[model samples]
Target: MKNLLYFFLLTFTVVHAQDKPNILWITIEDTSPQFIGCYGNKDASTPVIDKLAEQGIRFTNAFSTGTVCSPSRSTIITGVPTFKMGTGNHRSNYPIPDFIHGFPDYLQQQGYYTSNNVKTDYNIANEKDFIKEAWNESSRTASWRGRSKEQPFFSVFNFAESHQSRTMSMSFDWYVKNVWNYLPEDDKIADDAFEMPPFYNDTPEMRKQFARVYNSIKLTDNRIGELLEKLDKDGLRDNTIIFFYADHGEGMPRGKTNGINLGYRVPFIVWFPEKYKHLSPWGEAGSVTDELISFEDLAPTMISLAGGKVPDYLNGRILIGENRSQPKDYLLLSSDRADNGPDLVRTITDGRFVYSRNFMPFMPEMRYIRYIEIADITKHMRSDFKLKKLNTLQEKIFKTRPHEVLYDVENDIWETNNLVYNSEYNAILKKMRNQLDTKVLQARDILFAPEYEIGLISKNQTPYLYRLDDAKYPFQDIYNVASLSGLKSKKTAKEQIKLLKSKNEIVRYWAAVGLMSQNKTTLESFKNKLMVALHDKYPPVAITVAAIVHENFKTEESTQLLKQYCKSDNMDLALMTINYLLYVDDKAPFIETIKKVHDMPNRNYNVKAGCMDFLGILNIVENTSKTEN
Candidate 1:
């Protein structure tokens, strides 16, 4: 019996060694495949990436859940949608409980050495809440080299030389009035940018800036080459599964933080080394596949490669290894509050068509984040806007967005054309709308709340009440209110009033949204109730109350009432205060209140950045007036 047991243990160890492959993710930040030579950009100096593609399988249709780092990383970490995790806002960190561990924890349980060479900005409230057991080591010095020889590893390394911030000269780059690429002081870029996209004017400066970005890509590619060289020298190359991908798209104007293809589409290459080729679902070298994959899919793929079962809770699928599945028919995209203000956006794409729903259609897409304004691209875009050099198509992004947008992803990959208005595409529009609505409803997206409420819940470690079915605004309830708000019928005024008086704060907030949709005269009847709602505990409820005050009264008293929340210790409240105050009046008195917020310490980064930008724009306006005089 002892001999038999020993034989079984030896067999188990040998089989385990063969089945598990070391997964190494060489994560390059703030770049897209379009910027790489392998992805058809002749201007890019990306020999390493091109070589990786030659050795691996290249995926042309991979999408990221977000355009920015935090929200996208949150989804990647949790293997869940950003909204579902309640970490939807960029620069905000929401905690994950001990019991609910990330995929790395599962890998660690199976004795896999998990290491991350720094970059743990997972948008969690308590980053320490990260399960320590999930990683053998996670630091700048952490590497699979330190792991025991018998143990396979799952390691992630981030190269940020290509990040937008690195290309700039100063830490406060955005605060400067004029911004340009500070690296490679003497830029050697000629007047060319592959094919300048329609939005950009073909100018020497623009071409130079584009070339500077290519230079950064080249630097990042060389870094990748060095890392791969180290792997080959260690003689672990054949036993490893290598993945090269960007955090998101290139961080530039109309890309990066935006929820468009220019922002979300990323380069993905999976190298199943010759020794492990049979383990790969693709089972081939140097192939191109059109797979609709998202960052969420990475967690499950890693889990499967570690010889572990993918959990049902994870929305991702095993893209390779055992239990491998076909590519997704569609992938979802979501972006919310990239900076200080709110830009509630959700999208669904099936490789051919892309559809987006902008819940806050009243808000312009180019809200000019104070920090991001440091880029020269922003200065150029805004200058074009002021000079009226931009055509109607160019101005659309700066203006209030359409509630819904439909684009032919194949014909218009840049998403310039909105096919929603075309009667011929009505059926297609309906189908896309239904697909998006179903996704939102199915996820019970907590973004149904106002920005303040979303911000509030996101800041607090444990979620307020956002569960699949347990939230204050369940999927169907919010869906019903959403449908009703569109009608804006005077006949439903009484029903809305009842909702405003409901016990649930979410209900009252939606009720206010419905009331605000109506014409001022039609909504006048609720003046007293809105005033009472001003004293509501929740910021979302109070925001609606303030909106009503601005619409109905627009008085000094209302501004003062909103100002009370400026020092309320929450950036969201302060920014919302500024938003309301600015909407009502942008005079000296209101501007003072905004400055007061700028003066506050420990304020959220986005809010502080936003205030600075707003002040800068105001300064520009004031200077222009003086010049004219």
Candidate 2:
């Protein structure tokens, strides 16, 4: 009798799982809404995504948490913003909290076979140290059809056909042999087909590069259609909820790592099958909504649909199906410290208006980050900046930017005009400024924390928690001092100098960076204090002092101090030290210091991926290096 009872319970469990709906995510890399047909661009050929838009609700305002790949992908799977969870930096291989695995773990507990048909790069390292989870399987061979007949499933398909590396095929040889050579030569767009943005020169060669990007998009569209066709043939279309979107923005010159709309804005479409239309929040077919969505929301909405608990720790809220609810009025976006160097920027968008706050307003030379320099278009931009080929509006890229910028994105699409100085929009700009401040304080954003120490913060629950337990640097003071450049008072410099004596190493480091940028003339007045800072226990602080002493005093001690940092044992610190020397002169005496790391067999992925891509321009300038872009 007990054996019969067990059999009956098993049958009920299988039937219960089959009754739930299936969720499918089809994600592509490095694309914006501007490349798609339904999102205002009719020139590009994306019939599959356009058809999907027509069948479901299309979102006009959607964004990702971070502008870069690893950080943004990390937020997508965990339903938590990397900034709050202490995984904000790119590809650091940081350890996450014990309670946090991913939304798929919740679905698995509820009886769903979750599979990712190929890429799973969420930045957080997997427990086994191979990659992220491998439920059933996570490759091209993994499929929903392979599951039991009565078991519902959740599947994710990631397409990399339109990644930035693929777009560089026309000029970059690495892209040509690996990505472009595989595609049909005949499947190309017309030369000079689209209007180039203000950031790029309007030349025939520039237009040709843009054409290659459109062709890659075409390949991704074809792939999406094939996958959808398979769902129809298997008779699972009516039982599935299909979502199509991009991971982040395209990597076309200035678009990739920057915090502009071209970086974070993505095309998002959701196709609710006719039978499952009742479960959707907006059941109207072919309808469009102006609601804003973030990458962090995907996991929570999917977990809620699987009849599992949504963790309170998630930064995102449900945006689709029955559990959908609005959390805040505006969507926040940030980008920090990519492979190029240490850069910090934040943006707040309320669907139409955009307000940007640049904390590091003095470092305008970052416009030539290594990955961007590899593009043929940027070469034209740099030569134009020197030759006066560009207009005053186009020349803004070369110089330091103002503290704040405001844009009415609807009218000024390219964001060419700055209205922050304009009196008419002062009221709107103030409200937007206050809105951003409220969000930043509420989240306790660790924008000023040292990037090298972020990995350790992740293991101790989070940066915020560690600060609370230890009370180092008085967290809020660092953000205030980092933004001290905007103030004209001499007292601000005094405040930073006082903080230089702090017991905390990270606080002392940023204080030195702030003191130099705020007022270098005042630095000589505190030579005794500045000399003490030159020998800081932290390399980041000592490195900045090296730049200050060399740039201001030009002493022998500064050169020796600079050489010591160039050979730092930590790879991240070593590369940053090299970048600091290049910021002043075309070449440094310690170029061989970084070259030795390139020779080491035990180097980390961060050093391997960078290899002074930023500093390699010296060799290119000398016409000596033969490395790939």
Best by TM-score: 2
> Stretches of candidate 1 above 4 Å error?
1-15, 129-131, 167-188, 191-193, 450-461, 469-471, 482-503, 511-537, 548-553, 579-588, 624-629
- Our tally of clashes for model 2 stands at 0
Q: Rate the local accuracy (lDDT) of all candidates.
A: 0.72, 0.73
Model 1, 411-449: lDDT tens digits are 876678989889999998898788887878777777666
Model 2: weakest 10-residue lDDT segment is 620-629
**Candidate 1: deviation at residue 152, Å?**
1.6
Q: Which ten contiguous residues of candidate 1 have the minimum total lDDT?
A: 174-183
Quote model 2's TM-score: 0.90
Model number with the top lDDT: 2
Clashing pairs in 1: 93-123, 93-124, 93-125, 94-123, 94-124, 94-125, 174-374
